[model samples]
Target chain A: MRINPKTLEEVAFKLLEKAATSLPDDVKKALKSAYEREDSPTAKTELKNILDNIESAEKLKKPLCQDTGMISFYVRSREIENFVEVRKALIDATVKATETIPLRPNAVHPITRKNTGNNVGEHIPHIEWIYTDQDHVELIASIKGGGSENMSALAMITPGLGVKGVKKFIVDTVVKAGAQPCPPTIVGVGLGGTVEISFKLAKLALLRPLGSRNKDKDISRLEDELFNLINQTGVGPMGLGGKTTCLDVKIEYAHCHTATLPVAVYFQCWADRRASAKISLDGSFEFIV
Target chain B: MVEYRLKTPLKEDEVRKLNVGDILYITGTIFSARDQAHRRILEYAEKGLELPFNLDGAVIFHVGPIMQRKDDRWVVVSAGPTTSTRMNSTTPKLLERFRVRVIIGKGGMSFEVAEALKRFGAVYCHFTGGAGVLAAKNIKEVEGVEWIDLGMPEAVWKLKVEDFGPVTVTIDSKGRSLYETVKKSVEENLKKIYQQI
Candidate 1:
């Protein structure tokens, strides 16, 4: 089974557009719950309006939010060559779409003071490739909204604090960040790995199924404790106070330096707007509905 | 509840009578600016340009929104509010330099901004963040774009608006902020809820 470049570009571009306009079921579920649970007549009304906007945007094939974050893709490839060509074609496509599709441009170098106008920058589609035994590719795209991205936190504590420390950090950060990151978020907690690695792991954790487990028993149990403790924050739907503060807490961990215990907590708004696709060696791809 | 629609060049006495939670469907003229413009305003204060508009009874909205195609011009798409905290460091300077009477945005302001609001007889209003579309309905026209070079979502957009509904007073004229109240309550609730479990 061999994948071709043409199919990859075709599949990738379409997935990007669909992800922008359509709200996944998990996201809709979380949003609906938030709308129903919101208590402030003002905030509640606002949430309801947001929901209506989401539905209409999807129906009209328009962007859900004007901020349409910088597009980032994570691809798992196998025996793939011409990777450079693949990147060029995608960048061209992204730029073209910036005008044709008219996606808002959000990518700018921190200091250079340059705007890509197209979301693609120097290392634009920023791809992280994973190696697997088979001849297939699993690619996922997630939009990193600035508000929530700014709320991500990492703390290196003594190994002694363990789950207790993790719980406290998660709750404290969310409470302090109330409504800032857009609450009732899907939390991605990365444990173990080095500082940067752990932060990356947490961001990657967001790609997993909303309520799915890590498959490792210890990690799974820790996720449950953190999830329960987080929702208990009662930061509520929009921080107006409600039973559901977090839709789910996904944990991704890696072994770390013996003396170092690093952890990262990343939050994705209820939009949780992301989509994944599987490309078989035969050059066929299917989006995870 | 008090409501008034006045132009720029506001008077302090008119500003003093306004209270928190009072619904103001502000008409007349208001200037829009976000990160870049705020930074420039600070620079303007140091060099001292006559300033763009009268600030006494005027409202300043912190926004950088989507540009949509109108019949012949660009329009605001969900041109709703952005986070106000990011501008906290500049609000006091903005108020004192310009004598701004109203600061409209989402999220709350810092203590310094609150003090400035009280001292200046101004108030902070929290318009919905994602309600750009609904907020645009209040805006009758774009007026024109100020800094086109800043690019979308960063450029300073001047808009003439009508009755934009649903913008509530989160931070008030008397120096009390609803965001702070709710945030403080959230902290207490978290301590109580997590302390036991």
Candidate 2:
């Protein structure tokens, strides 16, 4: 059984590029819904413009924005009896994809603050392994851009803050962010962990479908409440005033310290970039691309 | 909010007409320079070198564009507004040195830049941040690059643009700011709504 690391990378590279130009189906549906419910004239106009932009991007093969974001992927690979060239393949794939897909070289020198000439860097384009052993490698590719990435938040408040305080903090963060995150955003909220874990979990929560309801009854109830409160801020589509400030409010939680209430909020823009693939140990592969 | 359609070599009277929140679709040639290139341009101006683009009444968009491959040519990727606060320190220097009239970017501008825009008869125009694809359509063409070696993202892209839709004058010549208005209003509203019943 053998897997072509070169092919895997090319697929990943092309997937990232496609995701930039093509809005995910879930995200598209959410925006269309947001446009229908948006009350502010200005916000509505912005929403329509965004939809139009999406259409043009698909038709003309132009990126949804000029700043096609930095590409990041999450991989879950399994060890089989064969395959020695996995690591080399991955690196070669990155460089190959960098040329083929031509991802904007986003990785920079940590100190000099200069681009690394390639998107690949020490910790960049991180490939987090999900630890699935099914005789194959499965990768989830996400092209996280800058604007929404800049809006990420984490709080290690006292236990006294509780869920209500958590709600208040999340609202403040998004409201203050205003139009900065690109309105009708998909918010990923992670609760109860160490500060770093909370931040990571919060970002992971963004992978959920746009309007899917949380299975946890208690968390789902909170999700509804926060979603309503956020939209009430009237920071519509582009912060020009609107009812649908966010397309969805996603929450994730883990066990925490006795005195700590760690919280994080990660915002995903309307672009909502993501794609995935599965490569079998038998050289067969499938990708969202 | 004031709306005007004027050509280059813009005068003080033209500058005086724009008010905060006024949406202007400016036409003409503008030089696009982001962080790295801005640093180089300022360094060049210090050494008394002529700028790549004519400075008088010129607009400088603070953007670093992404490149896409299109049949032997590299095109712009999603080039949207970056945080403009990063430019606060460099911008006044650029405005004073280069005589730049209009600045386009996202987020808030610095006090010094705002003050300079007013004093020097310039205006700080803000396009809707994150709407790069929409903004690109208004760009008629990429005239050329000054420093091609700077790579695709950091290069100083000269763009000929027309009616780039829906850019607001967040900072006007008379010294007004839409951010200030919104922030003040939000603050005032925050106090009223959150006050203990």
Candidate 3:
């Protein structure tokens, strides 16, 4: 049973709309817990406002943030019979979503700085493909705002410093970022790998649900330690000062060359908008929250 | 911290009375401008060109809103604050030339901008980051727009708002800044974390 292109387009459009208009359940839970744990009145007020905004967006069925963000799709499938058709359908979905959902046209020419006006441009609506043996196709959509994305960092450290070096780098990045990235952020750290891969992994790590731990024991422990250290910074919500600086720290790693340790950190502001769906070969689909 | 309701065309005395950490709910007119709009405004000033809108005693917002044209009128779908730090270099000049009373944005501006706010009798207020829907609900009308050639996000959107905030005064005319306070504390905490590592 081959999936129809129209069905793919419909699913993709729905995923984009869902990702933009609502907060995922895991993220909402983390924010509620943060609000409860917060001490400072200012931080509490900020958290309250955030919660209210989420409620308002859901109720109004509006885009959660003005910066609907540059959309990216992560696709996993068993086999691709026609890659071009699939890619075209995804682009068509993006255009339709932009008009109906009225997403802010975020894509532009990097050098010339010309607006594409439809949120589609060169290599945009970027698709990252992963192949699997599964019979159905899984699509994950995420919208990352410019403020938090601007705070992303990468460092090449001397291997002698080990995990100590990695911890220091992570803390330093968050501290320097301060309230700029919008505190109580979900910090995604990609350790090891090459230069580009490190940053990619960092962004990919952000796709994980808050409070989920890494499969590796050491990495999971580091995630907890970093989470605590970041919160201790007292940057709080919107950097006004409080104990809930970061809601969670997620780490993803890959083995690297012997002499170099590469670390990258990506931030996802509390909005943390993302959605996923699984499309069966018969054209039926189900959202995975 | 004290809470106050402010309206646009703000007076110097009212802005001067505000201090770091004060809360504000602003009404009246506010103009939206992001990075490109800032640069364009200055460029127009340099060329001795008349600006389409006035900035004197104005409330300037750092935002790139999502808007739609519904039949005959424009509707704000989402209008939230953008990071102000990106406008740090251009702000001091804008404050000097325009005497903008309030700067509404998320995150915070640089120390120099805080100082400029002091010298210019202005204040920097922080809106809740990513709270776009709440902001749109508060925005009552699109009064007009300017420099739309710069693209939708970069265009200057003149708006009329009602109780448009729960914005906190992060930097006041007195030169004190809540961001600076937070930064100092973060540094001290970072020292301890570094030692542990």
> Best TM-score goes to which candidate?
3
What is the lDDT for B97 in model 2?
77
Model 2 residue-pair collision total: 7
Error of 3 at B163 (Å): 1.3
lDDT, candidate 2, B1-197, per-residue tens: 55666555556667778888777777888777877888888999889888777878787787777655577655665566666776888888887776677788876676788888888888877665666677777777677778867666678887777876577777888888766665565555445434421
Tell me, by lDDT, which candidate is best.
3
Report every candidate's CA lDDT: 0.72, 0.73, 0.90
Task: Give the clash count for each candidate.
Answer: 5, 7, 0
What ranking of all candidate models by TM-score puts the best one first? 3, 1, 2
User: Model 2 Cα displacement at A160 (Å)?
Assistant: 2.1
Per candidate, chain B TM-score?
A: 0.87, 0.88, 0.97
Candidate 2 local lDDT, residue A79:
45
Q: Considering every candidate listed, which one attains the maximal DockQ?
A: 3
For model 3, residues B1-197, the per-residue Cα lDDT tens digits are: 89899888899999999988888888999999989999988898888888899898899999999989988877899999999999999999888878799999999999899889989899999999899998999999998889888788999999999998888888999989888888888888888877877
True-contact fraction in model 2 equals 0.39
Per-residue alpha-carbon lDDT of model 1 for B1-197, expressed as tens digits? Answer: 55566555457776667666666667756677777778877887799775554455667887766677757998665565666788888788888877777778765678888888888778777665555455665777787776567677777677787665445566666777666666776777777767755
On a 0 to 100 scale, what is the lDDT of residue A82 in model 3?
77
* Predicted structure 1: lDDT: 0.72
Model 2 C-alpha RMSD vs. true structure (Å) is 3.1
Model 1 residue-pair collision total: 5
Query: B178, model 3: CA deviation in Å?
Result: 0.1
